[model samples]
Target: MIKNEIKIKSEEGEVFDKKQIALAIRNSTFDDDLRCSLLDDGILDKCQGCNLRYICDGIDQVVDSYVDKTTEVVNNFDFE
Candidate 1:
């Protein structure tokens, strides 16, 4: 870990840093729309199904929110 690092844990307990996640998103060749197995169930689901889901939680809105939050944190984070 560093002053600015993207460390993330998958629903399956797997870990992914920023670069790994970014690459997975950028290099994905799948055409199916991401979906969360636990969408609207009031609890997060494990990273099941597609590989995208493994790293992205398989929900578009959730992924977007995660990205937005990450950006916000990066922009405002005060590293000491």
Candidate 2:
């Protein structure tokens, strides 16, 4: 089982769930046509606008890795 976690803080101080952060990332309107859209859009800015930005930043690398791995798995499976 994978445990997704996120912690976001505001002026009042708050914690958020990481899965929610992932959803935000998945739903972001940033142009996906570019290969590095996420990075180009400014990961910090995009995340900062998100409710779970703080927590999401902590797992950015992990999330990217997972996405890459999942894409490879799906592609390989499709080829098979």
The C-alpha local distance difference test score for the whole of candidate 1 amounts to: 0.52
Query: Ten residues in a row with the worst lDDT in model 2?
Result: 27-36
Residue range 1-80, candidate 1, lDDT tens digits? 44333565678774658675555454342443444556557465554554566445443555565566655433565689
* Local error of candidate 2 at residue 69 (angstroms): 2.2
Cα lDDT of model 2 by residue, 1-80, tens digit: 65455675678788787666666565342333213445467764443466665655655655566567665433433454
Candidate 1 ranges beyond 4 A from true positions = 1-16, 29-33, 40-80
Worst 10 residues of 1 by lDDT: 26-35
lDDT of the candidates, in the order given: 0.52, 0.55
**Model 1 Cα shift for residue 63 (angstroms):** 9.1
